[model samples]
Target chain A: MVEVQALSKSYVGRTVLDGVSLSAPQGAIFGVIGPRGAGKTTLLKILATLVAPTAGDAFVAGASVVSEPLRVRRQVGYLPNDFGVYPDQTCAEYVEFFAACYGVPARERAALAADLLQLVDLYHRKDTPADRLTPAMRYRLGIARVLAHDPRVLLLDELTAGLDPRARVEARELLKELSSMGKTILLTAPNLAEVQDLCTHAAILHAGQITQAGPFDEVLATTPPYRTIAVKFLGDVRLAMNLIKAANGVVDVQPFNEPASPSDALAGVTLLKELRVTFDGAYADASVLLRSLMHSGVQVVSFAEEN
Target chain B: MRAPHLKLPALELSPIFAKEMAGRMRSARAYMVLTVYLAIVSGLSVLLYMVSFLGSPRTVSGSGAVGTVVFYFLVGMQVLLASFVAPAFTAGAISLERENKTFDVLRVTLLTPAQIVWAKLISALGFTLLLLFATLPLFSLAFLLGGVEPRELIIALCVVFASALMYALLALYISARSRTTVGATLSTYAIVLGVVIGIPLAALIGSSTVSLALAPTSGSSSPLADLFDTLLTLAISLSPISAIAASQRFFSATGELWTFTPSFTGSGLALTLPSPFLILTGVYLIASVILYMLTVRRVARIEQQ
Candidate 1:
């Protein structure tokens, strides 16, 4: 488990993190999302016990980060965005070295290193020099290194950042496996879609402050109720727009960009124009409005939620 | 039933030390440095031997004089080379981690800050010891020629080893505080210059003025003369160069460690007790420990966002 209380950090005259608080339950994957310079990395560092908060405190696995950093470190495995591996050392040697640092006994280090390597699917390449691995392979090796001690909590800062799409998907799969093993994880990413897909809980940080945070479903439910539906019509767009505006639950109507409409590539779909309609009610109301358009003899080429 | 257990102490050699040793020992840089260091010492020793052999009167006693010159030359050369190489080995020890962005991972490990600092310090010193030991055969070669006592050889090694420890710690402290490896490297060299050249030069000038001021005493015994001699000895004893010079004095059977008879009253005053080499080594070892602690503290402070 990880808990942060009123954490704030500043450097010189600039404030980086201010009054940020969140919690991650055991075995849940908690994610942080933000734009560039949103203090996501700073918050992770504070939780990792690598940096002290200017005010407030963090606890990992029931140990206070400020007062019991060594204990906290023992319980937490932090993987920074750009953790480097030592040159000229094989993957197994690198992991075993960290294993020994964590006080894993000599008798067990080899097995643990081999286990982690297999877990990250790098067991076959265990003898390859660390610096010789490709970027994706190196990232997997870093994950293996962090798990040498089998800490209860994992702090991952942008594990998928700068990775290609295939590598990102693979990394997410590995994270899911870790999460299944009862490891509480705190990770950061710039992509909201990725975070929503992988996280059970999440917090959105904007300009050093938590704007919205909660269980994934609760946050998704609380998003703005305003919904826009786009429809590409085959006939006069003005007539279709008027018909949709007159339908029940329709708040407003506006023409959308031509290229954005899906009717551009459809053969025999001449005079195709897109109209966007605003709805303030539930999904049933939008469905009723769609039915009313069909009954009015207006041919709708494509219909979907715009945002 | 639990398996038979063997618990190792938590403070054994850190994984950082093992990792660094594995990488550094395998690198071509280590062997290259060893070769260059031995080559320089060999070249200088042969040149010094030729000069002494050709320039001196050919006699059984001449070999003693030749051995003395060669011994001092080797000591001075090794000390100079060690001073140059010690900082280079350690000044980047931590800063290179920062450059590689690996320090954050290290900081989050269960290893304490002291473990990290000591691991780096010991690894750098181990490499230095390798370099120091590489010259043992050469020193032995000089010993076979004559006139260099085992005690003097031991003392010189102690002085050089102590100097290496001091330089290693100084560079490490800078490495811990610096953000870039290049910056740490430059700062280490600058501070080494201040220790080796700057401090001794200032002390020489200061003590010379004191001696000049007392020169006009005009054949009268005074406590002020003792003060001047003490100041000179203290200044020299604090630096590596003067420490090595004091060892030379011990080998030459001069009044032990800056003791001299006064010109006017036929009395003698010893400026230092025990020995100048001991004083110098003691000061440097204490300072290095203090710096090591400070480095551990400094490294514990994480300063990035």
Candidate 2:
């Protein structure tokens, strides 16, 4: 439903998106993961037809964003990361206004607004002023506003950027429901884990380039099959290193000593130590390794896989 | 293959206009502004009427002069009010959209650039026309008192409306170019003041210099002098205040509200130009169309920036 071909965008002389390309099939939830200022928002804006790419073009729902922007607009519902609400407008009025903007008939707007508000779980607050809504509620209202047109493609930029954990979970569920409705959704996030659980197709964008792209498992398969396990402990560093080095599936161990502080010296306590172990093993083997470390009497503060 | 069927889009009220009007009219501040505007216009009209007719014997013939005084005063007041009010409504029209971060949302919709600009222009102009027309009863009162002609009232109202539109478009143009509402507003007012006050002041100085230069050669006609006269007429016609004054002068002299024929005097040195009201109307209409186009273009190119 969405295809981008070598799209490049530059501001003045600074290139923000450099020859990036990606594609998502119909009804796929595609997540573009990148850190802040990694040109993720620029990519979305180009696809949304709000910004013209300096080179190449993007297409949404088979319409070229450059040559046929209006048609593309008709096929895409874009929710910007930062948007403002009309100060005196109700949530229902806000949705209805966007419906009107999308050329929805006046007679059908009320029902449409009601249905959309219900979809975003904002039906109870339909009459409340939109600006007065909580941030999470407002974010949901934005989703409702974008869906007002019922476009086939949704370009949501950082949909869960500032949401609480519960709200983020709700947003993920909402995206899943939207995907189930056969709507192709393209969303952006600052980390892979935020979207890894929800996205069927994922792309990792960094420094204005796509580093990885495809189905979730295929993208992961392209990377080395090694997990870095971080262990923080307040025990003998040498013994912990030797024990981890001798453990099965342990490939490398790098120890980091926490700087000894005057307070620690006064308390007569051993300094804290952290070890990053690169392990090439199955999930079961990793758990067995942790159990052995615990049984060996080493005080483990944290044991977790990093990426 | 046969040509594809093509049809022009139907005319309808823009959704942006509808939304803006809904928000504007739903606010208590809108009604408060209307009430305050009506109160001031009404009080001023009553005060002007009393100042003209009070402490004097009520004479049937003197009512005409009183009506004339009151009518001009009210018209001038309306012009001044429009100059002040139009910018307040429109100087932030586009900049506020940027400030509120809604510009991209609107752009991404099916609303075309022209539609958005026209919607904004019409919404602001709609409220200004509301304010201008709210004083109609007062205008009718002046007409009933006898000296004000129907044509004069109509012409005066047209001038007020034109001036209001000019001011609104000026502010909107600045708004489209400015990044902040405060900057757009301050720049709009500065330019408006320059047009309203500075142009007339410059015309005065130019007229005096021309008069002084011509005093020595008062008998001969020169193209330079004629050009100066034409430019002076254009400048005076550009300012609403002087446009009103010129209209009054033309009416007092020719007793006509509009004319196409330009007259000359003083061996072609003194220029009795066409009706200043007509000139002002023509200039404003053309300039407004140009400004509208430029604003639309600016807005259309915003995403590129």
Which candidate number has the best lDDT? 2
| Candidate 2 Cα deviation (angstroms), residue A122 | 1.1
Candidate 1 CAPRI level: incorrect
lDDT of candidate 2 at residue B131, scale 0 to 100: 86
In model 2, how large is the Cα lDDT of residue B99? 99
Q: Write the per-residue lDDT of candidate 2 for residues B206-286, one digit (tens) a residue.
A: 888886797556556466666666678777988888888877777877787775234344454333556777777778878
Chain A vs native chain A, TM-score per candidate: 0.73, 0.74
Tens digit per residue, CA lDDT, model 1, B144-232? 77877777776677778888998999999999989998999899999888777776788778866766677665754357766666556
lDDT of 1: 0.79
Error of 1 at B250 (Å): 5.9
**DockQ of all predictions against the true structure, Cα-based:** 0.23, 0.21
For TM-score, the strongest prediction is: 2
Worst 10 residues of 1 chain B by lDDT: B1-10
